[model samples]
Target: MTQLTVFGTLTTLSPFHMAHAGVSAEIDQNGRVRKLGTGTAKLPCTPTYKVPFPLSGDLAVGFDGTVRAIAEVPCLPGTSIRGKLRRVIAKRIKRHFIATGQLLSREAYHCIQCGAFSGDGIKANLTTSAEVIAADQQLFTGIFGGGPRLFRSNLRTHDSYLYCAETEATDVLPVIPETTALIRAYQATFAHPFIRRDDLLDFLDPIAPDVIENYAEAFESWQNTVLVTQERKALDRNAALEARAAKKRGEVVEKPEASAPTEKQKKVMLKGQSALEAVMPGVNFGFRIDIRGDDAQCGLVLAGIVDMIKEENFGGKCASGYGRMAAHLRVMNERQEEFPFLDYDGRKLLVGNQIKSYDDALESGLSQLTSASFEAIYNPKTEPSPRKGKKTDDHDDDEG
Candidate 1:
């Protein structure tokens, strides 16, 4: 199988944030806030070589060196890339092509609701859409993603990072008393070189019983790398939140609990936490794409990436200015030969063959997603009527 590596840096135009699953976030009986998860602090992800410096901020100076740490998204997940690129390409199709309403291909043949595309269509016996997507369409499956495959090389992403200097300033800027305390907390993991591997979990998975347990010591040596917050506005505290974004739409926005920082805790805030965590503009994090596939498949990926660079931003807080990055896509083969997709300035994909700069692909993509399939896919059953039966003359009606 042939492979190509496209590597570049995600130079943040703004701060990025992603709180992973294992992060410990809690408030004790003392009302002190402790948030443990910050993806950048993970032991497996930290880089081997680092040029440590103080947490660069007006407030970072207060925290003792032992606790000063920064949090980052660590790596840009492949799903994020796939999803965003899908949307970008889909949107372009919608913008220049698709009109008011058009239906799209539904899930898979296994569906009790839909079974048109697959060979065996019996609703009673289901063969999942996931299976078909993986087998039938390599463009949808092989290039971007689909179901898993054996003996196959597809696309993958590398993690990004935080470029924090030292963790000196502890005093949190724009100190908002309680709401900022959690950000004020710090979690540190051991960052030594011997135990770190960019793909640690990949090695640990499906635990090998036959092989001697060699990594136990290395795993035990792992510690919580520190997480420090620079002084920052309590976004939840001050914002009208309702006007901002109601998170789960239609749900009431929860208010931030009032936390009174103790003198000692206040010093931590004075040190940093509420201070900062976002990889502000001008910071650069590494990003790479590894593709192990054929030329046409590689072209599809390159096209999607070009759209991502020209029109999209990766990572969190893209709603604001954060996560926007410049990606230079280069195709590197096993022979160490590199071909820069420099022609793809990321503006648009050229339609080849019958479709020219003058000719266009007939795109049937659409915005009207809430159609008949909405109910078939997953629609909530309506609430039962308040009244079971019609009112009778004999029954007295309730006051209006």
Candidate 2:
């Protein structure tokens, strides 16, 4: 007889032994130890004899292995390590592009109608769509070789698909509105490296004055959001600590005993649990925003979308519960927008509010406004995208 334990995400324990080699072992829903195997071979009493189990799934016995009694294996911690690694990788890739001055290119800004931006002072918007596609192609080929070629091809195809889908029957000559155009331009401009010089003034000269100011503003806004999230997490931790202290001191903390949870409470808890699981899959969630154009438009667009989703009941039901959900949104242009959303079953949820032209979104702040509109569009729906295929090498990693 052999005794072995299986550990995985499911809360059920399946025991296997030599006698039940072909049959499946029954496990309870709560994952508790239930029954032992029946196969037994009595031997002369020896002081050190113990049963050994092989780590491999194969049940066949071989002559060279020693027998030892099986013991419980410790459970592995889920996803925290993977999350850290993902953040590191995203940062590294961002830095590499910035250093190489390959984030933006002159060829990215050809005029759609006449290709007039070929000369100086003609005004141009960063071609974010093209730049991101190029950068991702470079990264995929550089790191993973031919494996990511299909992914790169898919992304290019998707971009073209989006372009056609979003722009069909629309004219291309209209000037994009100032606000939206600026956002796109900013994304393209900032992606470029700041040229180094002997003097501080010379170093600063390479960077556009407006670019520096805009980055500072965006950075400040990001900092404020991060601070608030940290403060909320701190408050939750403090409350938990206080509760533990009160229980230790024998203080009468008024609370309900373990009566049956109400239907609403049960639903909220279930949603919270699901959100937590969605945000942190078996691996850590990661995002990379590659701005091939002048500004981090896509990244900013995504951040704005995440903020709206967090506020409007996407992360379970309440703010406290939302904190427990632990979503990490990374912006990477080469791939489609990939992030875990409970509403989307942790799959890519494309909210296509395709405008006739970039000018339409620019004039109306389309990305920002439509982000909210799309939330309304998607909030009630639970269906996954049929377009979402199996996890390929090019698919962005998700945690949940």
TM-score of every candidate relative to the true structure: 0.41, 0.17
Model 2, 151: alpha-carbon shift in Å? 19
Report every candidate's CA lDDT. Answer: 0.39, 0.26
Give the alpha carbon lDDT tens digit for every residue of 173-200 in model 1. Answer: 2111221112221222122112222233
Cα deviation of 394, candidate 1, in Å: 57
Question: Where is the poorest 10-residue window by lDDT in model 2?
Answer: 156-165
Candidate with maximal TM-score: 1
Candidate 2, residues 1-400: lDDT per residue as tens digits? 1111111111101110111122211122332221212112111011111112223222122222533233211111122222222333334334444564434222321211112233432122222455435433332221111111121211110100001111212222112222221111001110111112322222344564456567656556755664465445334433544554567788866641323334543333322221111111122111222223212322222333343333323222133332122233323223444333222223333332321232242323322222222121112123433456577555768845
